[model samples]
Target: MKIKLKSGIDGLLFGMREKDVKELYGNPSRSYKDDEDNTIYLYNDKKLRLTFYADEGFRLGYIIASHPDTELSGTKIIGQEWPALEAQLQQNGLKAFEHETFDSVDNYFNEDNWTIFQVEFGTVVRVEVGAIINAKDEFDWKFK
Candidate 1:
């Protein structure tokens, strides 16, 4: 699937409702609440994990796509070496990542758009993208 920067992969925008997501991808293989008490829909077959935050009007707030299958600008993002992947991302107009590592895993964060590439053993394992709109104190949204 193609990555759309701050937007979502494919047509799954950042501010989409759970009902809308269900309509598009059908029922998830498994459904449960995450540590944060948000609802998580896991589509194992599609290698996708979508999180809907109850506080954000239950809109789709987080998306986690697994390795090898997810592509960015036609380039497969997972399983590539860190330096090569970083250069490729820069060539695609995404640049200047702040890398954080713990144990054997590395996370490259682009604060520019909240796109995170989680790498392990020098290869990317997953990609996460999401948005949290603070447009209003309550009952309002401005997608970022």
Candidate 2:
């Protein structure tokens, strides 16, 4: 069965403590400590780093995920040449839904991380991200 959960800090109330989120998601590939020393989590990759920003109250500002999987036909994948990847694709091949039809070679996002690409694919194909439900009111923020 598929389940959805809120993404922002409000979602953190569903038994998802800060430590738990870290443990499940793994140490952010990198982290940034604000002027106040509040830590913002980051998942770093060659092309993208999923970042989590926190406000004074620890509420998530937003989630920005980018993809760099699409590549130019003549360019190199990590400096190895695009032809090599294409050749490999033809050999190993990807899943049916993992492919995209790029109208032009210039329409690709160049980055080192492929996680964002996978996320984009999932979203474009109706795959879901963390969900938000049972929204917490100001009163909900109070944890005695």
Best by lDDT: 1
What C-alpha lDDT, on a 0 to 100 scale, does residue 83 get in candidate 1?
A: 88
Over the stretch 1-144, how does candidate 2's per-residue lDDT look in tens digits? 111113322223322434655655666767676676545566554222222334424433223333233232322233333344445534643212234444432122212112112222222211112223233622122222
TM-score per candidate, chains pooled? 0.88, 0.31
Off by over 4 Å in 2: 1-17, 35-38, 45-61, 68-144
Model 1 CA lDDT for position 9? 80
Kindly state the number of residue pairs that clash in model 2. 7
Best by TM-score: 1
Write model 1 residue lDDT over 1-144, tens digit each, in one string. 877876788767777887888898899999999787889989888789998897776788789998467898888887888789899889978887898989999899997777899999888899998774344733222343
Tell me how candidate 2 scores on lDDT.
0.33
